[model samples]
Target: MQSSVEAIFAPQPAPEGYAEHIGTGLTLRRSASRANAQQVHQLRPHVVEMAAQYDRLTMPVEIIHGDADTIVPMHIHAEELIKDIPNGALTRLPGMGHMPQHTAPQAVVDAIDRAAARAGLR
Candidate 1:
């Protein structure tokens, strides 16, 4: 992550107008908030179909989420992903925000190591 971008999301004292976009040259294009809402709107039937596909594939899976993240709600993504898989687990990190690799590298590495153990990769 860029220093300026990370600095923008850092915890800080409450300030008026502080939440305004902080950078000009940054370019990020993920599915829009509008698209996310649409996807969530279509969740139920989508999940049923997705679960069927997952069951057919029979793939092992794991999900990692930062509990304090606001940008992408962990419960919304990781919880659903875990629910979709037969033998999947979701790990939620306490006190970490948006990106654990940036906010808590050691914890992220530890999670990876544990995942590796689960996959017999270690």
Candidate 2:
């Protein structure tokens, strides 16, 4: 858990205009504080348990993930998740990153629409 926290807070070069868009300086201060690690540790078990039950989900599941995401690699996270879910559908956005809603809003909306249609909610 300590290693996980360290990786998350590990310094990386800022992407272009990142600070400008968020209107603040990117700092590793919060990561160094280790407050988030405790919260994650508490929630990790619950998250793992829920993930294990993905095969039992009856509702439509729409998974939209960026193919270019390094933080949560497509194969390791979304791809693996879809394999476990009976009704899971993955929408892989080419050349996109972790934040698909911000990077590919239309694709995200379309995926949501498809999920709703599958669930008869739209």
Which candidate's TM-score is highest? 2
Candidate 2 local Cα displacement, residue 120, angstroms = 0.7
- TM-scores across all candidates? 0.56, 0.73
Compose the digit string of candidate 2's lDDT tens values, residues 1-122.
33333333233334455546654433346764476677767997998999888899999999998777777888998989999999989988887766666556799889889999999999
Q: Give the TM-score of candidate 1.
A: 0.56
Residue-level lDDT tens digits of model 1 in 99-122: 666566787677778767777788
- Model 1 segments more than 4 A misplaced: 1-52, 56-60
